[model samples]
Target: MKIYDWFDGPYPARVRIALAEKGLLSRIEFVPVNLWTGEHKKPAFLAINYSGTLPVLELDDGTLIAECTAITQYLDVLDGNPLLTGRTPAEKGIIHMMTKRAEIEFLDAVSTYFHHATPGLGPDVELYQNREWGERMRDKAVRGMHYFNGVLANRPFVAGNEFSMADIAVLGGMIFASLVKLPVPDECEALRAWHARMLERSSVQEWRAMVERGQGVKTLPITADLK
Candidate 1:
């Protein structure tokens, strides 16, 4: 399997961490899609994934899977373990719900703020930006932090007792927030504590190490034969 993504990207980090958790990191090859160079938006890469997102999984038989949740779901079930997503119907439902909430209320909001309010991917990639809308999204992200803080105050994980895809989704939000210098409010003690514990996970540690190693490395050039 080959995963086309940019190292250190928050969305990619979610899938990378999931791969590490499933002990499948060694089984796959990582192809860097330079986010800074707008490689993902280019025609060559867009052919592989119409959405033009990073962390796309290309199976050995030429099957392509885009979107983090879908990729994680596929990888989670590959070993018949289904650890990250869920095993039971109830677990699946709750996990999926929380994960979607995490994306809408947090991660995606942070992304909008970065792309609009900040000079995200530079002027080349960001053709149109609405600073007003971005600022609103930024505020929404902060409110999301508070909301998650409330959720974490009562439970050990985002979805419930055990860490699931939902936790990873929130972690992606936290990662994006950090990248954009969006500080989690000091009052959100529960969220802060939860984030600290997440950082200690081996999968997250491994992802961090990979990010450190990826720093300053030149990205692969976009080409017609990316496959």
Candidate 2:
């Protein structure tokens, strides 16, 4: 299998964390797609993913799986135990709900703010932007932080006692927020604490190391460990 992704990006990092949890990181090839260079928009890459998105998973049989959620679902079940998605019907429903909520309320909002309010990936990639809409989305992302704070205040994880894809969404959003300097609300202590815990994971630490190292346009050969 080959994983089409760019290092240090939130969406790809989400999938990376999931792969680490499943112990599949070393079993696949990592293909670096430079989004900054508009490589994802090129015809060659678009043929693999029409939406021109990163973090695409090509199976050994030549099947393409797109979207973080779908890819997570595929990886979660590979080992018989669905670690991130869920094993039961009730768990699946709750995890999916929280996952979507995190995407729409937090991650997606942060993405909008990055693309519109700020000069995202330069003027080349972002052809048009709406400042007013971006500001609104920023506010919504803050509200999302508050909401997740309240949710975490009652439970250990986003979807209940166990960690799920919902937590990955939160981590991804917070990572993006940090890159754009979006400060978390002071009163959202629970959300802040959850993010700190997430950073302790080996997968996140590996990703942070790569980001801090500033290694650009490098294709990493698969290794046994997260390092």
- TM-score, every prediction: 0.96, 0.92
lDDT of 1 at 119: 99
- Candidate 2 weakest lDDT stretch, 10 residues: 218-227
lDDT tens per residue, model 1, 6-87:
9999999999999989989888778788899999999889999988788798899989999999999999999888999988
Off by over 4 Å in 1: 215-222
lDDT of 1: 0.92
RMSD of 1: 1.9
Q: How many residue pairs clash (N, CA or C atoms closer than 3 angstroms) in each of the candidate models, in the order given? A: 0, 0
RMSD of 2: 4.6
Query: Relative to the true structure, how large is the alpha-carbon lDDT of every model?
Result: 0.92, 0.85
For candidate 2, lDDT tens digit of each residue in 1-227? 78888887889878888887787877877777787877777777888888988888889887999999999999999879998998899999999999999999999999999989999888878889999999999999999999999999999899999988999988899988988899999999999898888889886776677667754224654222221
The positional error of residue 156 in candidate 1, measured at the CA in angstroms, is 0.5
The TM-score obtained by model 2 is 0.92
Candidate 1, 202: how far from true, in Å?
0.3
